[model samples]
Target chain A: RAEAKLIDGKAIAADVREEVRVGVAQMKEKIGKVPGLAVVLVGERKDSQTYVNAKKKACAEAGIDSFGTDLPGDATEEEVLKVVADYNADPNVHGILVQLPMPDHIDEERVLGAISYEKDVDGFHPLNTGRLAQRGREPLFVPCTPRGCIELLERSGIEIAGKEAVVVGRSNVVGIPAAMLLQRRDATVTIVHSRTPNSEEIVRRADIVIAACGRMEMVKGSWLKPGAAVIDVGINAKDDPSKKLGYRLVGDADFESCKEVAGAITPVPGGVGPMTIAILLKNTMEGAMRAYGMM
Target chain B: RAEAKLIDGKAIAADVREEVRVGVAQMKEKIGKVPGLAVVLVGERKDSQTYVNAKKKACAEAGIDSFGTDLPGDATEEEVLKVVADYNADPNVHGILVQLPMPDHIDEERVLGAISYEKDVDGFHPLNTGRLAQRGREPLFVPCTPRGCIELLERSGIEIAGKEAVVVGRSNVVGIPAAMLLQRRDATVTIVHSRTPNSEEIVRRADIVIAACGRMEMVKGSWLKPGAAVIDVGINAKDDPSKKLGYRLVGDADFESCKEVAGAITPVPGGVGPMTIAILLKNTMEGAMRAYGMM
Candidate 1:
C-alpha cells in the first residue's frame, strides 16, 4: 500500500504570508499607510482568544496593523455593535472581523451585517457569501477556510476542473462554500449531509473528497476511491492521555487509514489551521488594496 | 416498462392563480389597493414582447395591477435604467421585473442591480441570488422558474427530504437555485453541467432529477433510478418541418423513453411555463403584503 503524500499546508501558508508581506510593504510605500485589520471579540472564551491572538500576531509579522477590542463576557450586543460601527467609520481600518461564538445574548448576524461590505474581510457577510455563490460577480472576499482549501488543492498541483468532488457537509462557512468553489472551478460537485442516505456509496466514487462534517473520523478508509486526493477540514478534540492537554485535535477523516489509499492527504492541526490565518492576512491586504483603488 | 404519472402543471397553475386572485381581493379590501407588478421591457425582441404580454395577462387574471414600459429596440442603457429607477420608487409597484435578454446594448447586470431588492420580483440581483444560496437567511424572492419546479414536486406529493436530487445545470436562474432549494428541503444534491464527465452516470442515481441544461432530449430512459420523479425545466426548439414555424419545443429529458422508467414527470411547454407565471403572481402578492405591513 502506498503512503499518500502529505500536503504541507504549513510551508504553503508560509509562502503565502511572504508574498502578502511583500505586497503589504509595497502598498505602504505607495499609499503612505499599512493595511490594518480590526478583530472584535465579545466573549472571553479561551479558544476564541487564542485564535484572535494568533490572527493579530500574523498581522504584525506580515506588516499589517492589528487592532482589537476585548469586550466583557456579558457585554451588551449594542456595545459590541458600537465597536463595529466605529471601525466601519475609521479610515485606517481596512477590514473588520467579528470573532465567532459571540456572547449568547448578542445577535451575531446583526453585528456581522453591520460591517461595511468594503471592510468585510472575514467574508461572513450574507452579501459576500452570496457573491461567492455567484459567477462573474466577484465576492469582496472568499471565506478564509474554504479559500484555504482551494489554495491547498491548487498549490499542490491538483487538477480541479472536470473532477468529481464530494463535499460531506452543507455548512455555510465551510462545506457549502467549498462545494460552490469547486463547482466554479468546473468540478462536478455533490453535497452529502446527515440527511443523505447511502452517503458512503456516493463518497466511494469521488475523485476528490472533502470531509468537513465536524464529526470525528466519521469518514473511513473504504469511503475513498483509490488514489483520490483528500482534504479534511474538521478539527475535533479527542481524549488522548498521551498528549499534554489530555486531548488532541483529530480531523473528520480517519487520517491514518485514509492516507493508506488516498493519493494525497492533509494532516489535522497543521493542515487547514495555518492556511486559515494566512488567508486572513492576504484578504486584509487585498481589502486595503481595493480600498486604495490599487487593484 | 411501467408508464410514469404526468404532473398536471396547467391545472396546478390554474389553482395557484385562483388562490392568488382571492388573496388579491382580500388585500384590496383591507388596504384599498391591490398588488401591482411593473414589467420593464428594454427592447422589442418578439420573444421578450411575447413573454411580457403573457405576464401581463397572468397578472390581470390574478387581480394584480400590471404596468409595463416598452422602450425602443435600440434604447440606451441609461434609458432602461431610468425606467427601472422610476418603478423602484413608485408606491403602487410592489414588484419590479425587468424582462431578461435586454438588447445587447444595455448592461443587464447594472439594470437588475438598480432595482430595489424589495421590489425585485425577478430575483436576479446579487443580494437576492446570494440569499437563495444561503441557509438560515431568506431570499427576498426566489427566481420564479426554480420556485415553480419545487412547486411541481410538492404539488405532486413527492417527498424531497432525504432523497437524491440531481440538478443538471448550473445557470443561476434555474439549475443552481433549484439545487439550493432542494438542499434546503433536506435532499442531498449533486449538480452536473456541460463540464461534467459521465453526467449520465451521476444522473442515474437520482431519486428526483431536474433537467434544465437546455439540450433537447439529452437524458434518456437508461439514466433513471427506478420510480424517479423528474422535473424538466429546459425548453429547447428543435427543427421540425411538421410545424408551421418549422420548429418544435423539446425538454432536456427524452420524455418518451424517460417516462417509461420514471414514476412521474412534467412535459415541456405547458409544464414549467405556466408555473413560472403562477409563481410570479404569488411572489408579487407576497411582496405587496410585506410592503404594506399586512403579513
Candidate 2:
C-alpha cells in the first residue's frame, strides 16, 4: 500500500484565517467597528501566555480588534468576573475567553457562566454545549478545536455522512463535541479513551480516526484501516535534546508508522495546532456577523 | 467457567416500587398532597397506550397520584402545549411526561419544551439535558431508562467506578446520558454505536456493557467480556406465535448466550423494563422535594 497522504492543517488554517480576515473587513465596513475579542489571562503560565499571544496575534492579523487583560496569581475570582462583566457590557468586544485552569480559589463555573452566551467564543457555556448536542438546534459558536477538525475534513472534500468515524478521546473540550459534530454530519461516531481496552482493534475498523488523547504514539500504523483518514489532535511535548527547547511536539498517533497505512494523516505541531487559532478568528468574525444580524 | 448469574429485573423493580411507596407515603404526610404525575399520551398507538398504562399502574402502586391525557390522532400542537401549561401550573402535579414519537403534525420539540423544566419528569427539556451534560450541574430529573439501568446495577451490588464500561447505543435518551452518568461515577466509559464498525471487539473488552440500541439480539455472547456485567436496554418486539399478542419483548442482547459469558446479566422483559417506572417515581419524588425545599 502507498503511504498515506499528509493532511496539511497549517496550510488550511492559513486559508481559513484569510477568509476570516475578509469577513471581518466586510463586517467592520458595515458595522462601524472591526470584530473584537477580549482574552482574559490569569497568572503567568508559560503555555497559557503563549496561547494568549497567538490568539491576540491572529486577531491583529485578521484585522479584528483585540484586547488582553492579565491578572497576577493573587487576583481574586471577583476581579476576573469584573473583567468578564466589562466585556459583556462592551458591544465592541464580540468574543470573550477566560484562559483555562484558573487559580485554585476561583469558582470556575460561575466565572465562565458570567460571560454572555453571545460572547462565549470558547463555546464552553452550557447553553451552547446543549445546542451542539441536541438535534435541530444550532450552537451560535462551535468550539474552536472541533470546528477546526471538521473544517479540515470538509476542505478535503471527505464525505462525513454514513462513514465509520472513531474519536479516541472523551475530553469535554474535544472528544465529546467532536463526536456530536461527526454525528451531525451523519457519520457513525464512536468515542474511545484511556479506559477503552482493545482500542487499537476498534480504531482499525474506522474510515476516519481522530486522536485527541494526549498520549503520544498511542495509535500506531497497524491500528489504521487501509486508506483511513487520521486527524491527530494531541500535542504532547516529548523530550528531544536536539531541539533548542529540549522538547518536540508529538501527536496522539505515531506519524512514522500511521502515515504508511493511513490514507491521510495530520502531523503534530503543524496539524491541529494551526487550526485552533484560525477557528478562533472565524468565531470572532461570526460573532461580529451575528451581533449585526448577518448570520 | 462458572455459569453467570441472571439479574431478575422484575424482582428488582418490584423492590424499587415498594421503596418508592414508603417514600411517597412519607412525602404525602409532610406535604399534604401525594406526589402526582401527569402522563400526556398522544395518538391512538396501541404500544404507546400499553406503556402509558404500565407507568400509571406503577405510579398507583407506589402511592403517587397519576393523571392521563390521551389526545386523538388529529390533535393540534397548541392542544398539547395547553395541557403542558396546565400541568406546569398545577401545584399538585410534580412530574409531567409527554410520551415520545408524537404524531408527524405536532412539532415535538416545541411541545416538549412547552412543559416547564420543574415539571419535566421525562428530563427531555433542553435545560435539563444541558444540566445533565454539564460537569458541575445536576438535573432535577434524569431520563428514566438510563437511570433505571444504573439503579439496577447498583441494587445488584455491581461496582461501576474505574470499570471499563461500553455503551452500545448513543441515543440522546438512553446511551449518551448513560455514558455520562457512568463517567461521572469515574467509570472509563466508551460509547459504541452504529458508527462503531468493530463493536463486538470493543464490547468484548468492557468490564460492563450496556446495550440500548433497541435492536434484538444484536449483541452476541462472544461480544461479552468474561464475567462482564450486562444491562440490556433494548425492548424490541419479536414474533412469538405462542403468545396471545403474537410477539414478545426481547432485549438488545442474545440473553441465553450472553448469560453464559457475562458475570451478571439482566433479562429482556424483566431487566431494564421495571426500573424505568421506578426511576420515574423516584424523579417525581425528588422534584417534589426540590419544589418544596425539603431536599
Candidate 3:
C-alpha cells in the first residue's frame, strides 16, 4: 500500500509566521511602525476565549501590536458597533476582527459590515468577499481559514490550475471562498453540499478534494481518486474512551483509510488549525504596509 | 430525431416585462411615482447606442421613467464619476446603469463602484456581487443576465436544487454570478472555464448546463448529458451571406445538434438576449419599491 505524504500545515504556518515576523520587524525599522490588530470579543464562550488567546499570543510572537475589547456576553449591539467603529477610525489598528459566535443579541452581520474593509482582516466584509469572487478584482483581504487551506496546497507543491477540484461544503467561511480561490487559480471547481445527491461520485473524480463539511469522517478512502491531494478543513471531535480527555479530534477525511489512497493529506489537529492565526498576522502586516503606502 | 423543447426565452421575458409594467403602474397609482432608470453612456459606440435605445424604449413601454447621460469618447474619468454620483443622489432614480465598455480612457470600475448599491439596478457593484456569492446573505440586486438565466430555468419548470449544474465560463457578469445563483438554489455547481482540460466530460455530467463561454458552437451536442436543460447566454456573430446583414447571431451551443439531446434549450437571438433588458427593468421596479417602502 502506498502511504500518503503528510502536508505539514503546522510547519508551513510556522514559516509563514516567521516571514510575517521578519516583515513586521522590517516595517518597524523602515518606518517606526508595527501592524496592529484589534480583536473584539462579545461573549464568554470557552472555545472563543481559547481561540482569541491563541491569536493574541501569535500576534505578540510576530512583533505585531495587539488590541482587545472584551464586552460582557449581554452587551448591547450598539456597544459592539461602537468598539468596531473606534477600531475603524484608529490609525494604529491596521486590522480588525470581530470574534464569531458573538452574543445572540448582537447582529453579527451588522457588526461585521461596520468594519472598514481596509481593516477587515477576517474578510467577512461583503465588499472584500465580492471582490474576491469577481475575476480581475483584487480583495483587500481573504478570510483566514480558506487562505490557510490554499497556502497548505501551494506549499505542498500541489498543482491547482487545470485540475478537477471539489469542495465538500458551501460555507461562507471555508468551503465557498476556498472554491472561489481555486477557481481563480484556473481549476475547474465543484461545490457539493448537504443537498448534493451525488457528492461521493463527485469527490471520486476530483484531483483535489477540500473537505470542510464539518462531518466526522465523511470522506473515506473509497471516496477519493488515487493520488488525489486532500486538504481536510473539518475538525470534528469523536469520543474516545482511551484518550485522557475522553475524546479525539478527527478531520472530515477518515485519515486511517484515506492515507492509503491520497497522494498527500493534512492531519486534523496539526493542519488548518495553526494556519488561521498565521494568515491573520500576514493580512495585518499587509494592511499596515498599505496604510503606510509602502506596498 | 427527438428535438428538445425550446425554452422560449422571448415569451418568458415578455411575461417578466409585463409583470414589471403592472408593478410600475400599481406603484404610480398608489404613490404617484414610477421607477426611474438612469442610463449613463460615456462613449459613442454604435452597439452601446443601440442597447441604450432599446432600454429607453423598454422603459417607456413599461411606464417607467428613463434618464440618460451621454458623454464623448474622450470623456474624463472624473466626468463619468460625477454623473454616477448625481444619479446616486437623485431620489427619483431608483436604478442606475453605466453602459459597459466605456472608452479606453475611463476607469470602468471606479464609475461602477460610484453607483450607490441601493440604486445599482445593474448589480455590478462589488457589494451586491459579494452578497450574491455569500451563503444566507441577499444582494440588493442581482446582475441582469445571470438572473435572467435562472428565471428562464424556473419559468420552464426545470428543477435546480440537488441537480448537477455546470456553468461553462467564468466571466464576472454571467458565468461566476450564474454559478453563485445556482448554488444558492441548492444545486451542486461546477464552474468550467477556458483552462479546464476536461470541460466536455464535466459538462456531460451536468443535469443543467449554462453556456456563456462566448465561443461559437463550442459546446457540441455530444458534450451534453441527455435530458440536460441548456441555457445559452452567449451571442456571437457568424458571417452568413444568406442574411441581409451578412452575419447571423449564434450561441456557444450548436443549436441544431444540441436540440437532439437536450431536454430543453434556449435559442440564440430569441433566448437570453431579450431576458437581460427585461431583468434590468424588473430590478429597476424592485429598487423603486424598496425606495418607496413598498417591498
Candidate 4:
C-alpha cells in the first residue's frame, strides 16, 4: 500500500497567518486602525500563561495590537466580569478571549457569557455556538481549533459534501463543533464519544475521521478504513527517555501506523496546534472588519 | 417476523396534558395564579390561524390562561417586535409563541430574537438553540416537535445511551435540534440530509432512526436495520379516494413494510403531531413554575 500523504497543517496555518497579516495591513491603510485582541487571564496557571504569551507573540507578528489583563487567582466573579465588560466596550478591541480553566472560585460560563458575542473570538459564547449549529445562520466567529480543522480539509482540496465523516469525542471545544462544522458542509457526519460502544467499528466506515478524544494513540491503523483522511487533534505527553524533555508529544492516532494505511493524515505537534492561533488571528481580523463595515 | 409495537403518541400526549392540568391547578391553589401563554398572530394565513387556535384550545384544556394578539397582514416589523417586548415584560405571561411564516415583509429572525429567552417557549431563539447544542449547558426551552420525539422514545422506555442513532434531515426547527438532543443523551448520532449521497445505506446502520425529511414514504423496510426503532416525523398528505377527505396522512416511512421489520414505530397522524402541542404546554407550565420558584 502507498504511504499516506501528510496534511501539512503547519504550512496551511502559516498561509492563513500570512493572509491575515496582509488583511491587517490593508485595514490599517484604509481605516488607519489595526485589529486588536484583548485576552483576559484569570489565574497564574503556567499553561495558560504560555498560551497567552504565544497568542500575543502571534499578534505582534501579524501586525495586530494585543491587550492583556492578568487577574489574581482569588479574583471575585464580579471583578472578572468587570474586566470583560470593559473590554466589550473598548472600540479598540475587536476580539475578547478569556483563558479557560480559571480558578475553582469562578464560573466559566458566566465569564464567557459576559464577553460581547460580536467580539467573542474564542466563540465559546452560547450565541455564537448556537448560530454555528443552526442551519441558515452563520456564527460571527467559529471556535479556533474546529475552524482550523475545516481549513485544513478545504485547503488540501479534500471534499466534504456527501462524504461519510466520523468525529471521535464530544468535547464542546473541538469534537462537537467539528462534527457540526462537517455536517454544515453537507457531510453525513457521526459523532462517537467516550460513552459510545463499538466506536472502532463505527470509525472504520468513515471516509474522513477526526480523532479528538484526548487519548494517546487510541485510534490505530487497524481501526481506520483504507484510504481514509485522518485529522488527529489530541496532544498528549508520552514518556520518552530518548528525548531531552523526558517526554514527547503524541496525538490520539498512532501516526507511524496510520500514515501507511490512511490516504492523508495530520501529525501531532505541528498540526492542529499552529492552526488554532492562525484562525484566531483570522477571526480577530474579521471581527474588526465587521465592526468597521468593511466586511 | 412479529409486527412492530406501535408507539402511542396520542395516549402519551394525553398523559402529559393531564400532568400539566394538575400542575396548573396546584399553582392556582397555591399562589392564586395560573400560567399564561401569549400567542401572536400576524397576517391571515389559514394554516397559521388553525395552529394558533389549536394552541389556545390546548392551553384552555390544560387550565392555563391564554393571551392573543392579532395584527393585520401589513403590520410593520416594529409592531411585531413591540408585541414581543410587551409579552417579555408581562409577568402573567410565562411563554410567548409567535406564529411562524409571517408576511414576507416582516423579518422572522428579528422578531424571534426580540422575545426574551426566558419567555421563548418556542425555543427558536439562537441562545436557547446554542445552549442546547453545548455540553453541560441547558436551554430554558427546547423546540416542541423535536422535544416531542424524545418524549416518545423515553416514554416508550427506549435506551438512548450507547446507541447508534441516525437523524434524517437538517432543518433548524426539527432536524438539527433533534440531532443535538440525541447527542446530548449520549447516543452516537449520525445526521444524513438531502445532500447525502447514500442516506439509505447510512440509515440501514442505525439502531434508532428519526426520519424528518418531510418526504412521504421515503424510508422503506429495506433502508432500515432489522428491529431498529423508528420515529417518523414527516406528515405528508397523499391522495386517497378511499378516505373521507379524499386524502390521507402518511409518514416518511412505509408503515406496512417498516412495521414488519422494526421493533417499534410511531404512526402518522396519531404520533408526533399530538406530542408537539403537549410539549408546548409542558414547557409553558415549566416556565411558569420557574417564575414562581416552584421548580
TM-score of 3: 0.99
lDDT value, residue A167 of candidate 3:
98
DockQ-derived CAPRI band for the predicted complex in model 1: medium
What ordering of candidates by lDDT runs from best to worst?
A: 3, 4, 1, 2
TM-score of every candidate: 0.97, 0.83, 0.99, 0.99
- Pick the winner on lDDT between candidates 2 and 4: 4
- Worst 10-residue stretch by lDDT in candidate 2 chain A? A189-198
DockQ-best of 1 and 2: 1
Error of 4 at B27 (Å): 1.4
Write the residue-wise lDDT of candidate 3 on B1-295 in tens digits. 5789999989999999999999998998999999999999987899999999999999999999999999998889998898889888899999999999888788777788889999999899988988999998899999999999999999999999999999999998999999999999999999999999989999999999999998998998999999999999989999999999999999999998999999999999999999999999999999999999999
Docking class of 4: high
Cα deviation in Å at residue B184, candidate 4?
Answer: 1.2
Ranking by DockQ: 3, 4, 1, 2
Q: Write the per-residue lDDT of candidate 4 for residues B120-179, one digit (tens) a residue.
A: 999998889889998899999999999999999999999899899999989998998999
Worst 10 residues of 2 chain B by lDDT: B188-197
lDDT of 2 at A199: 83
Candidate 1 chain B minimal-lDDT segment of 10 residues: B126-135
What's the TM-score of chain B for every model shown? 0.97, 0.96, 0.99, 0.99
- Candidate 3 has a DockQ of 0.93
Candidate 4 Cα lDDT to native: 0.94
Q: List the residue pairs that clash in candidate 4.
A: A130-B130
Model 4 Cα shift for residue A99 (angstroms): 0.7
RMSD of each: 1.6, 4.1, 1.0, 0.9
Provide the fnat value for model 2, as a fraction from 0 to 1. Answer: 0.29
